[model samples]
Target: MALFSARRGSGLAAWLLAGSLACLLLVLVDASRMAEERTRERAHGRALVARVGLTDLALFNEARYTRHLSQADRHAAFQDHPGALEHFPAGSLAGPARPSP
Candidate 1:
């Protein structure tokens, strides 16, 4: 009476096929994870660049406004004073409206 099966090759082939399938699944999962991580990093980098651009624009506008105010002033652009120069305080000249003596 034979207790064990005589065929051994078929079992080995089935095990090898299962192992290969598992390895392929793992590789595909790892590849997809790496792709998703790269996409997320790219989006973060784009947002960082946009934030920097916005900050630069805000700074440029502020500088332009300050220059316009200085040019419109009667003290800085023209270097002229109202009435007497002795009545005004020293180094405080900033606007068109003069301080009354």
Candidate 2:
């Protein structure tokens, strides 16, 4: 069996296979960690949306609209039209999620 073992190159192939498996395991662990982080981020986003009482689409639109506007700018935008429907954020008020007839 020594002759066959010598021909097989001293267990290097086995060690290489083990190393490859370890690398794969590390990659999988890293991927799972990234997925967990993304899940937490999504949950936090959902919680904020719920707390503000808005749908995802509405929240996105409002954020985009207000992203460049400062508090004073927003105040000015609304100050001219007090209690106006157009001034109100789409999702801030209670309304149907979908359009109804």
Q: Highest lDDT: which candidate?
A: 2
The residue-by-residue lDDT of candidate 1 on 3-87, one tens digit each, is: 2323566666766787899999999989989999999988976798787753322222223323444333454433455433422
Error of 1 at 100 (Å): 73
Task: Give all TM-scores, in the order shown.
Answer: 0.34, 0.34
Query: Which residue runs of candidate 2 sit more than 4 Å off their true CA positions?
Result: 1-10, 44-101
Model 1 TM-score? 0.34
Task: Please write out the lDDT profile of model 2 over residues 52-88, one tens digit for every residue.
Answer: 8754353324544343332223433344454434444
**Residue-level error in angstroms, candidate 2, position 26:** 1.0
Q: Which pairs of residues collide in candidate 1?
A: none
lDDT of 1: 0.53
Candidate 1, after superposition: displacement of residue 39 in Å?
0.7
User: What's the lDDT for residue 2 in model 2?
Assistant: 54
Candidate 2 global TM-score = 0.34
**Which residue ranges in model 1 land beyond 4 Å of their true spot?**
1-7, 44-101
